[model samples]
Target: MKNIETTLRNVGTVSLVGAGPGDPELLTIKAVKAIAAATVLLVDDLVSPAIVALAPPGARVIHVGKRGGCKSTPQAFIEKLMVMAAREGETVVRLKGGDPFIFGRGGEEVEHLRAQGITVQVINGITAGLAGITSLGAPLTHREHAHGVLFITGHVRPGDSDTDWRAIAATARDARLTLVIYMGVRGSAHIQEELLTGLPASTPVAVIQHVSLPDQRHALTSLGQLHSTIERDQLTSPCVIVVGDVVRGVAAARAPEALRRIA
Candidate 1:
């Protein structure tokens, strides 16, 4: 038992880290420690440059960017690099944007590491969905307007079943749930169409782009005007789409004629 414990102690560890939104100040104390102590960092595309600068001067930094609709480093290659580094007795950190577990593919990386007998741990960070809604000074779930909150993805992996937006709209309407959709910009029109089948055309919605960053922008509109609003605002990928009456919770989201101006 003592010998086994000693052997494990000498093995290098891998930390799956969440880099928060774009703000470096949002970093957790533990995340900072892990990053500062890292020997190698596998950084995601959306991770803030400021956060990457937190690594020790001698620490190796490698960008393994994975973005929607863009050329990116292959996931298989990234995982392979992690395993190689850990077995070579290097402390590896996989830095991802937002919370590691929230659609960051941290789970798949963790499984791959564990299968290779590498020690791994995950440090939590603020998810973009929460940050995006909060940036608008609105709660995802309001006791009066929303009783539940659904954090769903607008994108799906290959060979995986696609999301049923219409059915989701039906459930959200009947249950008074708020929907936070990530990676949903390209599909906004189709989502809006299906959602309108079950939800009201006038349902309040907010599309927040680059949430928590200096370039952050948002537009408040109705479900019926979602796609048009996104187009008019020129909102692109990496945006969070908050749908439901909870959007109306924001003073800026409220309107006399039921169409608050988009920014």
Candidate 2:
């Protein structure tokens, strides 16, 4: 881990701050301070507008949006913009949804910045998977059901690197672990088939969308029906899919009133 405090003294420093999972209240005090002090704010698509509003007046707020399977600002361009702004003695804040280091490409950005001799600091934020499971009333790690949890991305395709979801499924079964998959909605069908090879068909599953937000919604199902459940519920992107016995805990904990309302 790079020492952030030592880098802060350098001029034109850049801070990579995690904006948390679609909720302004989830922002860390350190992240908030960095946003307030930023001279240039580079925002991601999933970052809540309420958080962006916290930037200081007269700050240059640029929307360098990046969404999977959608038109996005090129990564190289965004990196160049950040480097240019910092070289001009601006405090650049690369604000992203979720912890930047977790599949947010924070490491790449940090490497690019450091290569340019730009001072860089990182501030952690609550990732969507953590927020999503908690909001659904699920304990990620339950000693009785799940001894541990695995965070993986479900965006893998056939031609992509060999992720070996089957092997992971076998491990999860043997280890009694929960699997939290980010960006799993689009690839749920394939992921379900792969996991079903090792895991039982009846493994509990939960798909949470827009977690922690006012309009958040989720669906609970079994691994065998994961794809069907998503299709039937009309669930879309920006979803977190959890698979394991731990999901049963979330289903069991559903408030009676909430259940009645849904019914």
TM-scores vs. true structure, each candidate = 0.93, 0.91
Give the runs in model 1 whose Cα sits over 4 Å from its true position: 1-10, 252-263
lDDT of 1 by residue, 164-220 (tens): 988999999999999999999998988999999999898889899887999998888
- Residues 112-154 of candidate 2 have per-residue lDDT tens digits of 9999989899999999999998987778999899999999988
* Top candidate by TM-score: 1
As for candidate 2, its clashing pairs are none
Q: Write down the lDDT of every candidate, Cα atoms only.
A: 0.90, 0.89
Error of 1 at 49 (Å): 0.7
TM-score, cand. 2: 0.91
